[model samples]
Target: MPHPQAKIHRMFELVEPIATVTFSEVVNEAFLSLGMRNYWDGYFAGRAAPLGLAPAEVVHAVFYNFADGEVARHIPWVWGKVTPQEALAVRERASAVALRQQIGEVAESPGLVRVADLATRAAMSAPTEGRALYAGLKALDVPEDPVAKLWHAATLLREYRGDGHNAALVAHGIGGTEAHVLMALALGMQAETFGRIHHLPKAQLAAVVDGLRERGLVDAAGEFTDAGRETKQRIEALTDELAAPAYDVLIADELDELIAGLEPIAASISND
Candidate 1:
């Protein structure tokens, strides 16, 4: 088998996107139920179950994901009607539809049968806090397809990790744009990706960059300053620490097996 660290990295490369993309269908459908077209409508509505929280409370649960100003701008609008329970129910129902569609689209291929067992194995080995957090989430009443079950579990665990990361960001005094800016500098990610992912106004994003620069976390060119780098590492470390609970279930071989199995499927998904 591959070395443990290599396996872990590959597992992330393979599993992360699947966890992210498949779940988008559920979140997307939930927003569509509200008859909205804007990205924010989908984003907010989908995550209104942020950590399985109510809409009034979800903002706090997802504090680090949206800037104080950005969240403030949109959350009040969202909370006027939707509750956390409502959003959660929407996500649960939408997820079953999404799973059937995705599975049917791929099941004809040989990869579907193979990937599901491996993916489920990986998810089963994730942190217990993350796994246990799933207790509160609405389950997708999927058909007797193992692949669908794995996909649903992986998606829920990803959401759990995200909620934990958001909590870390909040505790560290970082908010939406600032967290993105810091991550961009530390990870060498494009600043533009942040705007696209979060739907931040250009001016608002720039303003946050300016604020981070003032705090000595980033330089004039939007690179990490020495202090910024240190802070970034700490934040990342903390996030991993928070996320580690889920990964702790696996031994090295189990992780390697999961990664190796998923790599081909990840490739297949990417090609299509």
Candidate 2:
């Protein structure tokens, strides 16, 4: 049997959009309500607001995947546009609005309440050590609205896993750009797609690819070699292992129910 952590990790994959979807109309309008014009500004400020105006370099480290200058370009300046408390409130409201629209009346269903409870239990159970973003989010009170509560629960769990993933990457000696390259190659995404997202210049990107080649993680064809696949799998396994503690509060049946109950809800938003 797969490890229980692996099952929870797969469930996370299906439900992740609940926390990560940034392009929907409701989310956009909500960010605009904060008087934020640029998407990145809202993104950085809203996500990092939980850290209470952390320095740009600190945000860059905790975020752990953007290019060097990318995070620094936004951080403290974004705070000037919106206070951390205001940003946090807007984010919660925006998430609630979007979830309610997508989920409709089912947002308050008893079944959803139970799922939210299970997820919140797990989120609350997770330790704050080395999980800065998760720790920050957990410091706030959960929303009183059921739908917002669910969204908050999922967001907390997402950041919890994210912090663990970053730890695994750092432990493996992977730089942010290199990690992106490995993930793109492992998942069959275009390397340039990640390059554009991270603002990496072609020469720098080529150097990263070359370094991976030297390490036998990629071949001349730029596909994952056997070693590359194993390395990716190992990192993922470690991430799941680290994330497992959150779900430890759930019994086997409860874990199963959590995943099942979340499927339709996640499907609702994913198909929207």
Candidate with best TM-score: 2
Pairs of colliding residues, candidate 2 = none
lDDT of 2 by residue, 1-272 (tens): 33476686776785597776534677667777767767777888889989997999999999998887888778888777789998888888887888888877788789989988888888889899999999999999988787888889999999999999999999988888889999888768768775444467878888888999999988998889999889899999899899888888888888889889888888888888
How many backbone clashes can be found in candidate 2?
0
Query: Residue 200, candidate 1: how far off, in angstroms?
Result: 3.7
User: What are the models' TM-scores?
Assistant: 0.70, 0.94
Which stretches of candidate 2 lie above 4 Å from their native place?
A: 1-3, 195-199
RMSD of 1: 4.6
Cα lDDT, all candidates: 0.58, 0.84
Residue range with the least summed lDDT across 10 consecutive positions in model 2: 190-199
Q: List the residue pairs that clash in candidate 1.
A: 55-84, 126-246, 127-245, 127-246
Please give the lDDT score for candidate 2: 0.84
